[model samples]
Target: MRHIILFFIWLGIGQISYAQEVRYETVENISYVDETASAYAKEQCKLDIHYPTSGENNPVVIWFHGGGLTGGKKEIPDFLKEKGLVVVGVGYRFSPNVKVEDIIHDAAKATSFVMKNARKYRGDVDNIFISGHSAGGYLALMITLNKTYLEAEGLDADELAGIIPFSAQTITHFTARKEQGIDEKQPTIDELAPLFWVRKDAPPIILFTGDRELELLGRYEENAYLKRMLSIVGHEKHKLVEFQGYDHGMVYPGLPILVKEINRLVKEKE
Candidate 1:
């Protein structure tokens, strides 16, 4: 069934009141790549983590920021704080400086690092989720759907607990198309598109998009198609949510939905 939700009402469903105070910590600029990697890789492929200081086995969320693949930095959203979860913000090499494949590999490497070291920060390795906004959302989908990237890191894409992308491009990212001398307005779906690699056995996916009329050109439609295709392939654990009255900058309202999905997935896993 198609699930179209109003952001305001859904936001209230996952609201949790903590009886005890929770403490959080932030560690910045930890390199995810090895020393033997290129200087640019060492500099660009770094991650920042915000985690609870006193909780054991807290769920982990790795966030990628939106900048259309050419810009933007890693950030731990303020909304995700003090929620008894570990949030990792990742930074990767931008295009023109590196190929989109390299950027995706960087994401995989960061995920591998978090999986290996989550225990050091009081996080559960098995309860890891990946998410991002816009271009960052695209990156999250790429690494999760295309197993080769994570496989190169000695990890499996299925290792993730869930995938939640906010207004991500389901087709070839416009930026990747631009690199190939294609117009941004022209939609293409090839290896770089998340739609190109749909399967029934990947992690549970929750796709969030802004209002259909207000989003970036065909953004909501692309995600809708992705949802349809996933169902056609017999994927049962997925949902597509469109926020009414919000545009492409819908990350704010979407954050609450993200938290709700994470909590729900964690509960289901238990």
Candidate 2:
């Protein structure tokens, strides 16, 4: 009887281990744009996908990297890997070489591609979340808030699971202003600004930023104003988080919070 009880315990341990095991795969450099797109568009509009192969209907997180809209490559954050989620790292054209509007269109195209091809990678189209740091965060907010961008791609921005931008610009991106010969210190809010598109009916969003005093010029203040405006517009599902000691480069600490929020949102959907 002792030997039999020991065998049963070993069997239970094996079953538990098997239940906890998950396999993941990474696919790199797939173009999101169509064949008719320009050469530069095809080159810059690629994305890398990292997804779990063992799970069905897993959530997807599309991440954009920060480079102030001038430079940055697609990269899957190591913290997001192997967590029973599909992560897409997007690449888009830079400013000056391409108009900022065109860069935003690239983000929409990538999102539409992911939404359309999600099931092929075992991802849940309904659980597709968008996020990024700084300039990438700005792109995430622009495409999510401004319906025209996603609408042009045959998608409704409201269909997204959520938006979680880290230290994103709430006003017109400085790069867009730079293209117009405006200095970075000057603040502007227009069609290119995320603050210009706030609505009560949009998807849930959680804006994360560093300390107000330690952040880049007006970064925290802009996000705070965006939160206030969202509340004034009667948007119920928006939130803002400030990390005390971190500055503009707060992606590392903010990523875990992003993962938590993603999980919370996913559970809410279930």
Candidate 3:
């Protein structure tokens, strides 16, 4: 009887802690400009976050918007917000304002910031998941496959819990190659390409793309190539999912499945 009473007391305390957890939203203005004149202006490069309430020790997802790296906004995906997870939506200077490399670095900065400060918001730093759509997906792959960027922040790519890229580019993104006057028909695996960085021991990766026939601009093919490369490298925890009727926009059609996958992955590790 005494032990039962103690158990209830302990349960009650835990409940209070969970109930006391709070949600938060904030922005981080990160800069990348080198010139003094442009530096302060670069500070406008900001990231918005929508966090859970009280207990910040849950999973975190650093999400990016899709605009081919040339156009996009910093907004969290609708389906992701209500899934009982912390979502950090990042905004970086676009291609014309800054180079693609700079944007990639900004994504890293935002992700690293989320990871480092997750505990304060009841987020589990160890369980950080990086995901994005289209251009955002490209960023996710870059951060996961290339250790150089995240390494600079003292965070290893392997440190990420999971990576789910929604129809990212498998080859060098056309916009990036365009800067070099590289034609679309060029088959070179340039350094700017994500395909140039596949490894065997990357964190768990789940690639999702629309049906091959319905996807935009061969996006599905790019995802397929990425999956193949990951496989060729002996990636153990990588998976490829095809959204049957979904299109390029991952807003509603792909939301439920994506959330389901995250929940499944989280539950599996538990």
Candidate 4:
């Protein structure tokens, strides 16, 4: 009974330490693109960064909002707030107005900005993570898997801490293929596809998908195949998770898993 009381006391102390408030601030509407970019891109290519005011080297996660690459404002998700890490919410131009390739270029540029400015926000550049839902996830995979994109942005792709995509498409994004006169039902894996860039040496990837029965047709299967291919190519770290009852809109259920993986990988890096 005495030992049990002491254990409870330790638990209470741990909780108190964990709950200690960590003050944070937001820097909003910073343009990630330059004057050479199109007027629409200059207007739309912005980001909002939220980071803890204290801590010299907190881990940072650059989050891309999901709007199918056509629409969505920059936002720092409430789920990630005050979690002792920096979160950069990125914004980029959309399709039909701009090609999907342009949107990906914007993503790479935003990541480069985050890396260059991480120190200003007390973030650790070596521990940067990329994550997003749906189309945002697709961009994360593209920038991390295809080195040339980040190379063009003057960032090393291999320096990324990890990639945690929530319900991303591994095939050529349907919207992109649609622009090319291909039916969404007829899937194709080409140069635009994340599957096209899978390599054994790419950064760790944790893929989350919603229920196969309810998700966008073949979404889970597509990520599963990517995971299988990553393994076949001898990639050492990768995961595929499916939420049994959720559909394509499963970001909320998947956020905790993302956080857990962030912690795990951050520790490994340390």
**Which candidate leads in lDDT?**
2
Model 4: per-residue lDDT, tens digit, 1-270? 999999999999998886675678998999988889788988999999999887788889999989888788888888988888899999999988989998899999999999999999999999999999999999999999999999998778999999999899899998899889999899999989999999999999999999999998999999999999999999999999999999999989988888888999989876
lDDT of 4 at 167: 93
Q: Which residue runs of candidate 1 sit more than 4 Å off their true CA positions?
A: 1-21
Among all candidates shown, the one with the greatest TM-score: 2
- The global C-alpha lDDT for each of the candidates, from Candidate 1 onward, is 0.92, 0.94, 0.78, 0.92
Instruction: State the lDDT of candidate 1 residue by residue for 158-202, as single tens digits.
Output: 999999999999999998898899999999999999999999999
Which run of 10 residues does model 4 get worst, by summed lDDT? 15-24
Candidate 4: lDDT over CA atoms? 0.92
Error of 2 at 253 (Å): 1.0
TM-score of each: 0.92, 0.94, 0.84, 0.92
Candidate 3, 147-230: lDDT as tens digits: 898998888888888998888887887778777788756655666678899899998999888888888777787778878988
Clashes of each: 0, 0, 12, 0
CA displacement after TM-score superposition, residue 179 of candidate 1 (Å):
1.5
Model 1, residue 104: distance off in Å is: 0.8
lDDT of 2 at 60: 94
In model 2, where is the ten-residue run with the lowest total lDDT? 16-25
